[model samples]
Every structure is written in structure tokens, then in C-alpha cells.
Target: MAATAAGAFRRTPIERSDQRVAWDRTDQAFFAAGACHILAWVCRESYSDKTIEIVAVRLPGQPQVFHTYAAWDGWAFDHSGWNPEPQLLAVNADFEGQPLERLKITEGLAEFCQKHHHRTPDQYWHDPRPRARDYIGRYIPPWA
Candidate 1:
């Protein structure tokens, strides 16, 4: 399931091409940059039956989300791959060295994005459904 979810978030050459400027400007890989939340939302849709949550990493007390991923049963999955939740949480340092906070959003993607970004996912990044379908096809996860 994790492997499939990771694959679903992998950007194809053209999707990469769609955001050519952001791709060229960043050091982060595919979904690691601005699109991490969309990646998490797609992954959550893949494992819909589980108690998976979309987790956002942000500076403490800040409404802005710096990163996002999917978490289920102590494991976290992003485009980068899987990590134990604790290890994933260990990397949240800002330029000033303030420890960022982890926000677990269970209310769905619209709620998550609206709360963190003051906009819906489509307003923030490309709508995720097409990319998810492109990779996962009609294959539902085992639990589903």
C-alpha cells in the first residue's frame, strides 16, 4: 500500500513540465516542495479505509504550512518515501532554529488547505485527482 501510494504521488515528466518554473527554482524533489500537501491528500485518498491523516509541518503558532505528508499507524509517507512518524517529525527546523509543529488534519483536504493556506487545494496547487488516477488506476488499496 505504501509503495503504491508513493508511486501515485510521483510526478510524470509532463506534470513536472506543467510547473516548469517551480521545478527549476527549487532544491526539493517533486512533491517535497510546494506540492507536498497535494501529495499527502492523494495518498490519503489511496488509503481511504485506514485512519490515515494528512499531517502538516509548520512553524509553531503559524498558520502557514511548510510541508505536508500522510501518516497512518505510526508511519509517514510523502513523495520522498516512508518514514517512521518520529523520524519524519525530527526534521522541522526553521532558519531561526525554532522547532516547528506537526498538525494532524483528519477533516479532509479542503479543510486542511483552507486552514493552513487560506485557500483550497486547487487554489494552492493542481487538483490532485487526475494525477492520482494516472498512477493508481482503478486499483483500490487492500484495506479498501
Candidate 2:
């Protein structure tokens, strides 16, 4: 299914997460790729599970941050936020509430980066740019 056609995935709010991210260099590369869809696609190709999803979210004013994780049983694994990296603003899983698709993610990312950042697919893919820091530096739990 198309990324746009897939509609919105249910937003899963993470109440608390550990302070440090124990990801290795390869894992960090995947998270970095979340900023650009082409890199995301490349990441998907390298991994064994093509079903893994990559999500990019942008707040009203902040630069977009990408979250690369797999959704299962209404939760995301290998997710980042409420920790070293920026807090995740939103997530799109696949259908049946899983908001992910390889083609759609890449296409949407390409369109968005080109229109907003004036970046071509190749430029965004090849360039070394800092990832988006945080959607909001502070976090207050829903129950709070």
C-alpha cells in the first residue's frame, strides 16, 4: 500500500525510557537514515526483515526526526525517545495499525525533503547532515 494511502498509525505514547541508547555503530546508522527515506530504503535492504518500518516525524517548528523500529502487539521495538535522542513526536505503523511501507516512506520522504529542504533524493541520501534533535526537549507523561 502507498504510504499516504496507509492513513495514520495509532500514536503510542512512551511513558518512560532508559537514559542511554546501547546501539552500536550500525544501529546508529539506521537511526540516522531515518532522516532521509532513501537511506531508510537502503537500511531496509541491508536488514533481513524487510517488514521493519522507518518513520519520520516533524513537529510544528522543529526539524524532522526519524524513528526506525518494528511494531508488534501495539508496541515499537528498538525505538528511541525519552532518552539520549530526541523525543519521538509521532509514529506511523503498518495497516491493522502498522504504519509502515517501504515505497511509501521513501516517496513521502523524497517529496517532503525536496519541497522543504530543497534537497534532491541523491543529496539527502549522500549528504552528511545532523539529525533532528528533539520534537520537544521536555517530556510530561500523559498521566501526569
Candidate 3:
């Protein structure tokens, strides 16, 4: 599944872990990766507002902020506004719904998320890096 918005496109229905018994282990991995302090798998009753919410703290003692990303059309993710940091990028990346592969931790938290959750860089997410920078990062292919 894919979503097209403002001429931009993205994929969906990403599986971070197996749906069965692996769910618990996968959740732990995601937490250990430091991508988020609390990752909740929520089910919305309305299609008009169904989404996955990921709450995290950028650093210890920092205020906790709620980041909501859509998990429809076969993908999951949210935009980081304009700030581009590794931690924010990692949190958004996790919602991308794709497995973490070949993704490096330019930011400590993103790297932690990738390693602990076993995600690929090619996975979809609203990357804060510029187009050229995003490509150069090799976290995901620009053309992809």
C-alpha cells in the first residue's frame, strides 16, 4: 500500500515484528533501541482519524512530546517539522512500518532504534535530511 500527498508518495503496512509471539520481543527491542519511551499500538474506531501514536523524549529530563504518524496505505510515519536530528529521525523512521535494514544511526537514538528493532534504512519515513543529504546518508535510496 502507498499514500500520495502533496505530490509525495509513501508505502504502508510495515511490520516491525512478527504478529505472533514475537510481538513482545519486538516491542522490547524497539524500546531498548531508544526510539521511544512508550510505543503504543492503538486502534482507532474511526477511519477519519485512525493513526499510530509514538511518544518519546529526545533526551533524559527532556519534556515528553507526542508524535503521531499515520499507519495506513501500507506505511506508517510522521514529519519532523523542520528540525533534523538523529533522535527525531529515528522516531519517525520507526513508524515507517518497514523493517530496518542497512540504516545507520546518524543520530544515537535512530541508530539504537535500527539496531534494536532490526530495521532497514530503506524503510519509509518523513526524513528531516535534505534530499541530497538523505541520499548521501544512504539510509534509504532517494529514488526508492
Write one digit per residue (lDDT tens) for candidate 3, span 39-89: 212111122254423323222333323232223333333232222234334
What do the candidate models score in CA lDDT, each in turn?
Answer: 0.59, 0.32, 0.29
Off by over 4 Å in 1: 1-20, 23-28, 94-96, 118-128, 132-144
Question: Which residue pairs of candidate 2 clash?
Answer: 92-99, 93-98, 93-99, 93-100, 94-98, 94-99
Could you say which candidate leads in TM-score? 1
Q: Write the per-residue lDDT of candidate 1 for residues 111-133, one digit (tens) a residue.
A: 76667663345552455455543
Clashes of 2: 6
Task: Tell me the tens digit of each residue's lDDT in model 2 across 35-99.
Answer: 33443433334343436454444333445433333322232223232221111222243222433
Q: How does residue 71 of candidate 1 score in lDDT?
A: 86
Give candidate 3 regions above 4 Å deviation: 1-51, 66-75, 80-88, 91-144
Which ten residues in a row are the worst by lDDT in model 3? 3-12
Q: Could you estimate the TM-score for every candidate?
A: 0.64, 0.30, 0.18
- For candidate 1, the 10 contiguous residues with the lowest summed lDDT are 1-10
